[model samples]
Target: MKKQKIEISLEVFETISELPKDIQELMNKAQQARENAYAPYSRFRVGTALQLASGEIVLGSNQENAAYPSGLCAERVAVFSAGANFPNQTITSLAITVRSENHEISEAIAPCGACRQSLAEYEQKQKSPIAIYFMGETGEIIKVASVMDLLPLGFDAKYL
Candidate 1:
């Protein structure tokens, strides 16, 4: 067997002001959504916003349940809503933001594994890469070119 390594590249922004105007707007929306997250248990509120091909922006906030597994991440909630509401439209970009109970975190937050898988499915369906912008509670931003970069060897429809 041969050893192999994979590396992912992302643009790091010390502040949201460095992002494009439109992307900055989306990030702002994500920040606003975070305030409404129903995260009583964990107190880790998260928000996500998606920009669709139709120029529509969709937003989602984390919703927690007593049963942990039943809850969904903000990223998945936003992506799934886009898939259901705009079946024909492709997702162009997504912005995610997070907040914690103790204090705002400065480091960027990446999507969870399940959220990456869902994003990968949509990326495959559209046959186009989806840009991901993530920001921490304290407002540092990081941009990734594609969902596949987050989930290498991700399971998709092709494998079924």
Candidate 2:
């Protein structure tokens, strides 16, 4: 048997100000979108903001429902909107952030598996990488060069 190794690099920032101007703005937009989340159940509000090659920024917040799993994640919401609204445009970057009501969160959190899969589809469609940035309510932020970095072995249409 043979073994293989896979590694991904991430950049950590001490504060929002440490990021580039455009990224900082994207993060800020995520924060604003976060405030609109309807997290009555989990109290785990999440927000996502993505920028297109056309310089348009789309924002989304976690939406909850009475049913167990009818809700959608912020990343998927933003990505779907971008796809529907601008089918021909390529998404360039994405920023995600979360705020919890029960406790203080200080570490960066990545997107869930489902969200990752959905994101991978867009990356595949555009034939380009979408830079991802994520963080908690406070503290450091994390940046990944692409969604594949977060999901190295993600499933795509090619698998079918």
Candidate 3:
């Protein structure tokens, strides 16, 4: 047997203004969506905005539930909405942002494990990479070139 390794690279921007116009727009939409999040339980709001190949942007906010496990993350919610509404369009870029209650976020927020798997599946289906931009409530922005960068060695249909 042999050992293997994986590597990923990301860009960190000093401010949102450093991003491109379209990316900036997506990030703005994500922040707007964050305001509508129903996260009374965690008080940690997350928002996601996905830009499809058709240039349409879809937004989603993290929805929490008393049951806990029933809650869905912002990334999955936006991805599912895009799947339901624009099944034919491929998702190109995604922007995610988070805000903490009673405190300011100081670093980029990465997607949870489940969201990463879900995104990886879409990347496999679209046969293209989905760029990701993540931000905190008050700090810098981090950009990943692909969802695969967040979920290496992800399981796919090839395993089945």
lDDT of 2 at 153: 81
Question: Per-prediction TM-score, please?
Answer: 0.97, 0.98, 0.97
Better TM-score candidate (1, 2): 2
* Candidate number with greatest lDDT: 2
The reply for model 1, stretches above 4 Å from the true place, is none
**31-138: candidate 2 lDDT, tens digit per residue:** 999999999999999998999999999999999999959999999999999999999999999999999999989999999999999999999999999999999999
Q: What is the TM-score (0 to 1) of candidate 1?
A: 0.97
Count of backbone collisions in candidate 3:
0
For candidate 3, report its TM-score. Answer: 0.97
Question: What's the lDDT for candidate 2?
Answer: 0.96
Q: What is the lDDT of residue 69 in candidate 1?
A: 93
Off by over 4 Å in 2: none
lDDT of each: 0.91, 0.96, 0.95
Cα shift from native, residue 160, model 1 (Å): 1.3
Ordered from best to worst TM-score, the candidate numbers read: 2, 3, 1
How displaced is residue 42 in candidate 2, in Å? 0.2
